[model samples]
Structure formats: structure tokens, C-alpha cells
Target chain A: MYKLELKRLIKSRSTLFLAAAMLGMSVFFACVTVAGAGSMESRGYITLRGMEAIEYQRGLFAEVEGYVTTERLEEMSDYSVWARDTYGRADNMPRDVYERWISYEPILSGSCGRMSCEADEYYAERRAALARLAPSEAAIASALALNWRVDEPFYWEYGFGGSEAGVNWTLCLFALCLFCTVIAVPAFSQGYSCGADGILRCARLGRGKLARAKILAVYSVCGALYLLSAALFCAVILLTFGPDGSSAQLKLGAFVLLDMSMTGVLALCVLSGLITMLASVSFTLWLSSLLPNGVHVLALSAVMLALPSFVNAYMSYPACDWLRLLLPTGSTGLQIGMYNELAAYRFLTLGPAAIWTPFAALAVPALEAPAFALLARRAYVRHEGA
Target chain B: MNIEIQNLTKKFGKKTAVDSVSLTLTPGVWGLIGANGAGKTTLMRMLVGILTPTSGRVLCDGADTREMGEAWRDMLGYLPQSFGYYPEFSVADYLDYMAALKGLEKKAARRKIAELCEILSLTRVYKNKIKKLSGGTQRRVGIAQAMLNDPRVLILDEPTSGLDPGERVRFRNLLSEFARGRIVLISTHIVSDVEYIAAENAVMKAGRIIDAGTTAELLRAVEGRVFTARIPERELERAESAVRVVSLKNEGGGETLVRYVAEGPLLPGSDFAEPRLEDLYLWLFRDERRQDDV
Candidate 1:
């Protein structure tokens, strides 16, 4: 039964079309990221862009791919001051000078700032900022404790650009959410829309077992689509930019408090994305079971999936923020999503207790997936045909 | 096997669709005859357990069908009045899907599907999508799905509506052979579809079962009242308005043969005709037909 249900869904032209669109979107975003990649050099006024720039930056960072010791930091700082004094701006420096000096500027700048590079001053300032910005004292303490896990002498590497760009591209996740909505909104409602429910519900196993089969098949299809798209997006980006910074610390590029490598961050992002996709699909299935037809389910699910973006854009109240963060598609929004939440020091406070936004985002959808799936099954089984 | 409908009633807002209807069904081919909106479709839907009744319950073997749940559904088969199918599904795919839902094993399902396809004359179009089939062929597919499980109780609504006379004859034969020891309830306005095959018949009007019995027994009400008379062609319209005209056959030379129902012979040289189930149906739903004409 499950096999037949899966086959039925796969046979749908709309499902096939949307799946192709999703994969195309994934590759398109990857290509866009790669096309936009470029690096500036001052070697007799020669500038590199695209894959050329990426390779140039990769080679420059390869030589410095070790722990950021005091000597390296001082040497970088000395070069930065010399280049600024001589050229007045790095872009005005000679190509050889820019290649030798400024090409390594990103590594130097991120590690040397008070916001990151210096451990004691960074943490102290961070704590004060946390106390000021954190929703509660518990949040401040949580952020401080989590910050301690950031690997000291931050490991510098050359390949994080692709992984970072792939994971942080909000449009990729948004498109995926919409595709999943289009796929799942008709899971149950199609029966009603086509008038098949009257006959199906009369079958021996049609009510409960068929509902279960539909739910499982929809989840399997949508989940596989998500994994495939994410993999393809990562593959395109990583292949273009070269996979060399899998072990590099995220701290080198983003203001993330988690002590995780670039690969670890990518995994977290993908895992959170998969969970959010399932949760959103499950919610749509529940709506499918309740609505009379697929059109209504599609309209309502689309609105729901897009609501968080609008709320985050126009609203600032605590309740509005909570609503934005708690929605099933909350982690896939453009303004506030899993990637942004992971890098920001935001927290959701509940009286004295506080939880990190990334943790809350992952947890909410993880719980909602199974809960909504159960609700969807119940609603389907109990449905009375028109 | 037995299906007992006890005081079943269904209402949509202020309109009553199926009102306090009670009947018991046993193993045999039974016909439910009614006009449009006479509640035959609504009653069939309730018997299939897809629509909940506002009051009362249906019992299968003395146990409430609601409580029987899947166990009761396992013994039942239903073909709705107008059903829809996935446009992508081929006739074979649809039958296989329904077979699986009926809890038939894959091997059994394959065998049953092949047999039903052959029996229903759908073997040639087995691979064709259902949407592309003719209306009569689609109705056969619906019938095939309903009987795939060899259910103990089968309910078909308007099973022969779109079928040609030949196809309708085949369907009637199939149902008669299949219902030897099973309960088959067929609801249709075309009384003749079940007139010959139905072991018993029920007549519905205004959400109630106005009459039910064997064809011979139910015909007793209209017996001796059904008559055939020769009238002038110009008087045909007057005769139709003056009495319940079951049928009108025009003869040569400005003469028309009219079969009608009335208390006594109202026309010159009118002879009493044999009352069939259709005569009883026309007699019971004459008021509904009058309203339809208005």
C-alpha cells in the first residue's frame, strides 16, 4: 500500500514538475553564489573574480591554515598598518603587495577585532553586551557559557565560503518550503477534490491505513526532495569554491556563539532545514484533511509559510517575534531564519528561563513534525465525505 | 450477513436529506427505487458509512456499524452515485489501488483485477487512463472496484445510469450471479435495471421508504389500476396532464397507445395491464414528477 501510494504521488505531473523546479532552484542559487564570487588584487591593477578569485583566495589562505598564534596575528597587523600607510587604502596597493598582504586581510580582520580575536576582552565585552541585549539574566548566562566553547586559537582555512553561502542563502530555503507546500497540500484533499474519498473511505483499510500510507509517502517524498536539493546546492557551491575549510571554525566569518566547525554548522543548518520542512509539510497535510479541496489547502499553506516573513518585516513586539519564531516555516524565512538565528545572539525568554533561538527553532519543528503528522492522520481518518 | 438500518436520519441545516428510515437487509439483490432528491442516494451513502446520520444507527449482524468500525467496513462494498478518480490513474491502476485499500493481498488483488476486467469488458482499456474512457466504461470501472473484495454487502448508487442497454443487461446479469449468497443493494431511478433481478424492492419518496416488498408484492398497490388505452394523437397531451402516463407509444394513423395508472379505466376500451415495479414507482413518485414539471 505504501509503495502504491508513493508511486501514485510520484506519478502526479504537478509533483514531478515541482520537484524539478526545486532542484533547478538549488542549482540556480549555487550558480548565482559562484558567479558573484570575486576577489580584488592590486598587482599592477589586475582584479580576479568568480572561480579565478576563489582560487586566488584559496591559495593565499592555504599557507596560513594553522592556529592563529600571536606571531601570525602581529605579522598580519604589521602588514595591515604598512599597506594602509603606503597606499592609504588596500585597493590602491600594488597587485603583488595586495596579493601578499591584503588577500589575507579577511583572516586577519576577523581574528584581530575586539568583538572576536582577543579572548579576554572579547568575552568581557560580549558579556556586557549580552547583559544589555539578552532577554533575561538566564539568557546572558547561557550565551556566556556557550561562548566558552568556541575553539581557542581559531583554526583558519580557505573553504568555508561555499558552505557558508550555501547554508545562509535564505531564498534557497524559502523556495524549498514553497515546493514542499505545493507537494503536500494535496496529500489528502485530492481525494475529496476528485470525489474519490467517497469510495476510498468505504474500503476496509481506507480510513486509517490509507491515511497513514499517504502521510508516510508524502513525508518520504518531501524529505527526500529536501535532502537531494540541499545536497545538490552544497555540491554546486563546494565544487565551485573547492572543499578545503570543512574543519575551519565558523567564528572566522560569522558572530556565532556555538563552538562548531564549518562542516558542523552546515550539518546543523541542513538538519534544522529538514525538520522544518517536515513540520511545514505535516501542517499542510493536516489542512488538507480539514479542507474540502487542494486549492484551499494550497492557498492557506502558502499564506502560513509566507506569514513569518511579513511578520518579521513589519512587527517588533515580543508577541510578534514569538509568533514569527514559533511558526512551522519560521526557520525558513528571509529576515529571520535558522542560519541567521544560529549566528545572532537572540533568545526566546519565558519568565526566568531562556532558550537560544537556534535551539528553539530546531526543537519547535522537531516536536511539531510528529504532532502535526498525528493530527493529520486523525483528521483524515475521521473525515466525513461530502 | 445482514444490515439493519434503524431510524436513520440525516439533515443538512433545515433540509432533511434522509429522514427516520428503518429497514433490514439480508443476503440477496435488493433494489431501491426513487426519483431525484427522493433520498435514495443519501440513504445509500449512510449505509456505506461515509455519511453520519443525524439520528439512529446501522447494525451489521446485530452490532452497531459504528462500533464495528473496520470489521464492518471489511464486509462492505460501495459505488457512489458520481465518483471521481485520479486523472493519472489507469483503469488497472485504479482497480489495483482500490483492491489494496480493500485489504486484498497483492497476488489476490492481481487475480481479482484481471477477472473483473474480463467480466466487465474492460480488458481492452485496462491500461488506459480512466478519465479518457467513455462514461459507460467508467461506470463499469466503478462497479469493478466495488466487487474487487467480493464483499458480503455491496451498495451501488445509479450503477447503470450511463450504460447502454446491452451494457446494462450485462451488469444486471453480473449482479444477479454475484449476489447469490450476498446482500447487494442497488439504488437507481431506472426501475427496470433491477426489476427482473431484484429479489425484493423498496420505493422511496420525500426521504422515506414509502413501500418495499418483492416485485410481485409491491406491484399489488398499482395492480388493476395500470391500463393501456388507444387515444387520438391530439388527445395525448390532455391524457398526459389528466392522468399519470407511464409511457406513450404512437401508432400509425393518428392513434397513440398510452399506458397509464388510475383508480379505474378512465378511457374508452381501456384494458387493465400487468403492473411491474415501474408502475408502482410511477404511482409512488407521481407527485414528485408533477412538482418537477411545474
Candidate 2:
């Protein structure tokens, strides 16, 4: 039955078209990103490859540390000279001074050697907030503490620069969600729509085997789409940009990507994306059982997949913080970086608390996939010919 | 096996579709004849175990189908009134897909499908897509799928609905062949389908089985009650309004031959005619026909 269902799925022309379209979209965007990076690199703005990026940052950080002095800060503090030479002009300042100033901002701010009352209060709030974390979240926070990098100079690389990786990973996940929705939206409902559900429900394999086969087929298709799209996107970006940042610290990639290896951040992002894919497929199957028409399921699922991509722009409220993280759309955002933000909650005893946004994002889908699968199975069994 | 329906009833809110329908049968074709809305479909659906009954049970070989679940389903073969097909699939592929759903292994399914294709004379069109096939051919495919597993209990609802007369005859012969050891329940509005093949006839009226017996026994209800007369063509409407006209034929200019079922002859020159399953069905469902006219 599983083999037959797979054959039927592969034979569907529309499904094939949709799969190809998903891959095409990913490849097209990847080519455009690479070309844009090449154009920027030609204009004396060099982007480092993976290992070269790590070596360049290590070299720059060491040089910057040598010049992180009170006298340099005093000179930089001189308004007339600073404004005349380096205020808004990019080419006037020496590269070493600029790198030191940018990379050691935190150290320079605390270099006065006296802790202000405001800083004291901030530390107290951070410690109190850290104490409020769940056991799992606290464990994660402790793990992160063990590998924390104090300060690292940013690496400007072809594929890893600006919002390149964030945008690429985001689109890769969004495309995966689309592929799953298109494939699974019609999974259960097509039987009903085509009027085959009645004959199937009464056959020997109809009771449980048929419904199980459909779900398994849907999962197989979704899993393939995720792997193909992720691999294609990763290959294109890494090949074009050169995999220089694999050994680089997460703090170098983004200000808040803290305490993790760059590769670890990439892996977690992909894992979070895959979790949401599972959740999307399971939820669509459940919805297909409930909805009367297959086309309606398709339409609603497309909306569910697309609407979440825009959620991060408008969603901001303390009350809705947990609600936002638990949504399927929230998982598609740059949750890898968002997990490290400590601005929202603070603990006086334990210092700043690590956010559990990505963990919650992963957990919601991990829990929802099975729950929806059960609901869908019950619906299929209880379904009459009508 | 024996199928015993001990006081089965199914109701949809305020309306009852099958009311206290009961029967016991084994190893023969039992034709359930009824008019539209006479509960033939509801009864068949319940027997197939797809719809839950409002009351009562259907026991196959003393095991209630509701409790037996898949075990009962395995013994059953059903072709619903309107079976759906995947339009893109060829006839062979459609049958193969159904065979998989029926849990037939590839080699066994191929053999069964080959045998049925010969029996149904569907060999030539086996490679044709279902959407392009004629309605009668599609119906034959439905019949072919129902017989795939050689079920112990076969239930067909309006099995001969869309077949041509020639196809209908062929289907009836096939049904007769298949009914040797299995219990076959065929529900249809076409009375001739039951005329030659049905071993026992169950007549449905409203939501109840008003009568059940051999074809000869069922015809006994209208014995000496069916009459034919030569009437003026202008008086056909009056005859139609006043009596149950089973059929009408043009005899000559300004005259018509009217065959009808009634308590007595309406015309003095009317002569008695042999009662058939048609007359029996018309006589049984006359009240609903009158309601339809109103």
C-alpha cells in the first residue's frame, strides 16, 4: 500500500510541478545573492571564505586588543579631531584603529575603571531575570556560558554578510513550508473529493492501512522537499561565498549570536526549520480531514505558510511574547539569533537570562505533530462516505 | 455464510430511512426492489457497515459486523450506487489501485484482474483512461473491483443502474455465476434485473420491506389483477389518472393498448394478463407514485 501510494504521488503532474517550482525559486535567489556578492567584492570590498574569515577575524581581534588603551579612547573622545578625521568618513581612519573601536566598544565603555549606579542596577536586574528561567532553559544558559567568547571582530564574507545567511535560511525554510502545504493539503481530502473514500473505507486494507499509508506518503514527500531545498540552498550559498565561517564564533556573525560556533548556529537554524516543516505537514493533514474540499485546504494552507513570514515585523508585546514564539510563523524568523537576546528579561542573582524563543519554537512543533496526526487519524476513521 | 439482519433500523434526525428491516439469508442472490426514497440505499449502506444504525444489528455468520470491524469488512464486497474513479488512471491502473487497497498481492491481483476482465468483456478497454470510457464501461469497472477479493458476502446497490440492456443481461448472468456460495444482495429499481436471476425478492415500500419471497410468490400478490385493454388514445390521460398504467403501446390509429394493475378491470372489454415482477413493483409502490404526482 505504501509503495502504491508513493507511485500515485510521484505520478501526479501538479505535485511534480510544485516540487520543481520550489527548487527553481531557491536556485534563482541563490544565484542572484552570489552575483550581488561578486559585484560588491569587485569594488575593493573583499569578502572572506570560511577559514580565511576565521583567520582574518583572529588576526584583526589580536591587533585591536593591542590598541585598546585609555589614551586611544581619549584621542577618539576629542570631538574636533575625531569629527574632522573619522566621524562620517569611511576612508580617512586607519583600518586598525577603526577595527579596534568597533570590536571593543563594550570594553571601552567599561574602561573608566569605576562602575556607575546604572550599570549596577542593570546587573542586578539581569541576575534576577536569570533565576526565573525553566530548568531546561537554565541548563542551556549554563552550557552557553561555558563557551562564551568575550568580544570578536565581525567577519564580512560573501554569503555570511549583512542579512545574507538570515535571509537565505529564512527563504529556505519558507519554501519548505510551501512545498509541504502544497503536497499535504490534498492528502486526505482528495479521497473525499474524488469520492473514493467510501469504497476505500469498506475494503480490507481500508480501515487503518489506507489512512496510515496516506500520512506516510505525505511525510515522505515533505521530508524529501526539506532535504532537497536545504541542500541546494546550502550548497549554492557555501560554494559561492566559500565556507570560511565554519570555525568563526557566532558573536562575529551577529551581535547576539553569542557563545556558539557559527556552524552550531547554522545547524540549529536548520533544525528549527525542519521542526516547523513537520508541524506544517501534520497540521495540513489534520485540516484536510476537517475541510470538505481539497481546493479549500490548499488555499488555507498556502495562507498559513505565507502569513507567518511577515509576522516578525508587526509583532511586539510583552504579553504576546510567549504566544509569538509558539506560533509556526515565529519559527521561520532568525530564531537562532533571537534566542540570545537578554534585553527583555533580567535576573539580579544569575545576571542576564538567555531567551528560550528557539527552544519554545522547536518544542511547539515537536508536540503538535503527533497530536495533529492522532486527530487526523480519528477524523479519517470516523468519516462516512459523505 | 449467513447474514442475519435482526430488526435493523436507521434514522436521520426526524426522518427514518430504514425501519425495522430484518432478514436472514445464505448463498444466493436476493434482489431488493424499491422505488426512489424507499430506503434501498440506506439499508445497503448499513449492511456494508459504513453507516451506523440508529437501532439493531447486522450479523454475518453470527458475528455482528459492528463489533467484528475489519474482520467483517474482509468478508464483504461492496459497489456503492455511484462509485468514484480517478480520472487520470487507466482501467488497469484503477483496478490495481483498488486491489492494493483490498490487500491483494501483485501476482494474485494480476490474475484476478485478468479473469474479471475476460468475464466483463473489458479486455479491449483495459488500457483506456477511466474518464474517457463510456458510462456503462465505468460501471463494469465498478463491478470488477467489487469482485476482486471473491468476498463471502457481496452487496451491490443499484448495480445495473447505467448499463444498456445487453450489458444488463451480461451483468445479471455474471451475478448469477458469482452467487454460488456467497450471499449476494442486489438492490435496484429496474424490476427485470430481478426477474430471471433473483432467488428471493425483498420488496421495499417507504422505509420498510413490505414483502419478501420467491419471484413466483411475489407475483402472486398481483395475480389476476393485471389487465390490458384497447382504449381510445384520447382516454389515455383518464386511464393514467384513474389507474396504474404499467405500460402503454400504440395499437392503431386513434387507439392504444394499455396494460395496468388494478383491483378490477376498468373497461368492460379488458382481458386478464399474466402478472410480472414489473406489475408487482408498480402495485407495491403505487402510493409513493401518487404522492409524486401530487
Q: Which has the greatest lDDT?
A: 1
Residue pairs of candidate 1 with colliding backbone atoms:
A42-A94, A42-A95, A43-A95
Error of 2 at A168 (Å): 2.9
DockQ each candidate and list the results. 0.85, 0.67
In candidate 1, residue A180 scores what lDDT? 91
Docking level for model 1: high
TM-score of chain A of each: 0.92, 0.69
Query: Per model, how many backbone clashes are there?
Result: 3, 21
- Model 1 lDDT per residue over B83-174, tens place: 68888999988998998899999999999999999999999999999999999999999999999999999999889989999999999999
Stretches off by above 4 angstroms in model 1 are: A41-44, A112-120, A162-168, A244-255, B289-294
Query: Highest TM-score: which candidate?
Result: 1
Fnat of the models, one by one? 0.91, 0.70
Least lDDT summed over 10 consecutive residues: which range in candidate 2 chain B? B285-294
lDDT of 2: 0.70
